[model samples]
Target: MLLELLLASVLGFIIYRFVYGDKEETLPLDDGWWGPGSRPSGREDESIRPFKVETSDEEIKDLHQRIDRIRLTPPLEDSRFHYGFNSNYLKKVLSYWRNEFDWKKQVEILNSYPHFKTKIEGLDIHFIHVKPPQLSSGRTPKPLLMVHGWPGSFFEFYKIIPLLTNPKSHGLSDEHVFEIICPSIPGYSFSEAPSKKGFNSVSTARIFYKLMQRLGFQEFYIQGGDWGALICTNIAQLVPSHVKGLHLNMALVLGNRYTLTLPLGQRVAALLGYTERDIELLFPFKEKVFYSLMRESGYMHIQSTKPDTVGCALNDSPVGLAAYILEKFSTWTNSEFRDLEDGGLERKFSLQDLLTNIMLYWTTGCIVSSQRYYKENMGQGFMNQKHDRMKVYVPTGFAAFPCEIMHMPEKWVRTKYPKLLSYSYMARGGHFAAFEEPELLARDIQKFVGLVEQQ
Candidate 1:
């Protein structure tokens, strides 16, 4: 117990140092105990245990029953996803989920890649670690950590995993093979949730960094989008030297001067260093930034303040959980998709793939803990943390998917990632870049790392 208290004090000091320490700052290699109640005596277990995703008939039956019993409100005539996951479309997904979506098969696919769980800070941190099947002689696989965000699971990278780990077989250059590690953010799925409050992206980054070191990696690359983007960014900030390179498909460059000039018209926006594509996507700034944030951020507002309240219903009702989670997949993948009758979900993702992700949350009953992350990070205020204001010094690459809900120009991404080495306007895809455009994302990662290697 005393050790746990000491751990807490040490973590606090580390964060304080990062915020107030000198310019030559480096985040501490602190330890923690995140298990429930009081931390146990003695050094925490450091063993890595192999894991497999499993499901039972009863669990499947219960989910099917919930789908059978769902009482969906009717979408107003001609109304699409504008009002959220349209009830009409939810029916199609629910029908497939109940009748044809095979959870057992999906579980097998999930287990195809090796998984491991190790205790970090008292919580069982779950991650999938995949090494390249075959490396050229004298070649060593690069370690890449891919993090997922809200309404997303490690499953987001399942398709992209094979590509990165075996690019030679995937018809892509084998110049940079990766041993990929995709960890479920604590409380996201198989990973154990923090017993106490205040576990946010920074804590996640620290845990993941330790996870790599424990797996025998002293330095590795990091890649992410959504909350994953922020978590990877924090890893770079906390331990820039440990990160060989950082890559992101999404960025949180809020309140930067680049965004501030967005409303000044494209002429002024260009003066601020935006590209013509940026002007095309960001003009009528009200519709793109202000109105979009206002319209889409309702969930953020509630989750940041009262996550448990909303998470209660979501955890209890599988259908309600799907509606809540899938809504983001629809709008985030392409805001315009929301105008379609089916919300255009299946255009980019298979129903089995989508439901498999939802099932991770549904089976684990982690909606509440996962929702609490928002409160931990944003409950205080957006961009209010030390890392939020700090610039990352590590070499960074960004892939700007055109259909991302809010268009973040290259200039905006560069402001936060000062060491931005590569930026690409992805030909197609949206927030779920890896899921929708695995080949494209994989190529970009390879391209970015290739440049870093050249340096």
Candidate 2:
């Protein structure tokens, strides 16, 4: 049996209240201050500063010493990843990380792009701003904001940035050259973690919106997956005029009553507004959808209620953190990868690439803060929030990557986004779409922008 890469069980409400009404609800764009203690007197600083990633010998030596001492537990016979990262295979990764992995080289790769920080809500907001190296005559690059989700950082967009910014060099048409801004959500990587409570996606959207204004973009395109998807949606909601277009690879749209007919709805799917592809991807509901959802959600349950407790060990032990985080990369990339002895981790991604992501959490010690976001967002319960009850009025485009943990039908997406202009069923890829399939994602983004530009 092959396991599909599991979704962030952090997706709220196993038994969601799937209701739709004619209320025409809109999101309230509220302001916030997320610093520790009470809000400080006087205005918050609004200066932007250039930043670079650097690693020292002391950091490398400390990491090496930790890896050398990781005690291992043995896995049961041929368990593979059924029981989580097989400890047997982890030894291989440990050996590579301990003996061959190069943090300094990866740091250099990270710094290849321009990075900057600005204070938003009293927290240092980190983001990368990429401009086309050369522009055609009389052309201005389009501005875009790409937000990252949990277990992922701005690094995921590195490969795709050049493809979008300098498409002419990559054999793609130069119709949509872009100036891209990829931001680190507060409490992730280089972005300062929120010291106070209630720092959910809404605050994040406001902060990123402020970031765009600080960068002098009155309006821009927004894209994301996982938490990034929700943040982009909130950005559209909070300030629809400021968002020119919204693109996503993941959505948290809870299914309405019609979703329950999935097992036998294949034959009558069209009658109910579902596409053939939706039926093909969603049917066999028990194995592919229900059980898979249940199997993958343990982390969400723990994170939503006690993220700090679960993340304590993860923050303390790098190997443990890798096991916890990398397991998602394996199972989520392609569920079938779970059966391989090595979890088939490198099939679509290099260890260097994967470890660099892990290093972000390890170096920043933001695991607990990152996990707490789930608690802050979902601990209060799903569908009970203001944004959950609203619809995004912005023009939207969706890249439905075939292997995405769950399929978001066109009709389903339209319920949340009234003006969905483009919906493409991608030929390949999964949850971490940008990281695994840059060209495909980039092309999809370009295609969506083309459609948006025309309208």
For candidate 2, the C-alpha RMSD (Å) to the true structure equals 3.7
Estimate the TM-score of every prediction: 0.94, 0.94
TM value for model 1: 0.94
Question: Candidate 2: global Cα-lDDT?
Answer: 0.86
User: In candidate 2, which residue pairs get closer than 3 Å at backbone N, Cα or C atoms, i.e. clash?
Assistant: 3-335, 4-335, 5-331, 5-332, 5-335
For candidate 2, lDDT tens digit of each residue in 1-455?
Answer: 11222221112223232443544555676778888778898988999999999889998898888998899999999899999999998998988899899999999999999999999888999999999987758999999999889789999998999999999889888899999999999999999999898899999999999999999999899999999999999999889998899999998775344554555546777678787788888877776777777777889899999999988899889999999999999888777777898887988899999999999999989999999999999998656787876778889999998877778888778867879999999998888999999999999899999999998
**Candidate 1 deviant stretches above 4 angstroms:** 1-24
**Clashing residue pairs in candidate 1 (N, C-alpha, C atoms within 3 angstroms):** 32-121, 33-121, 34-121
CA lDDT, every prediction? 0.86, 0.86
Q: What is the lDDT of residue 54 in candidate 2?
A: 85
lDDT, model 2, position 439: 94
Residues 401-447, model 1: lDDT tens digits:
98887888877777667789999989999988888999999999999
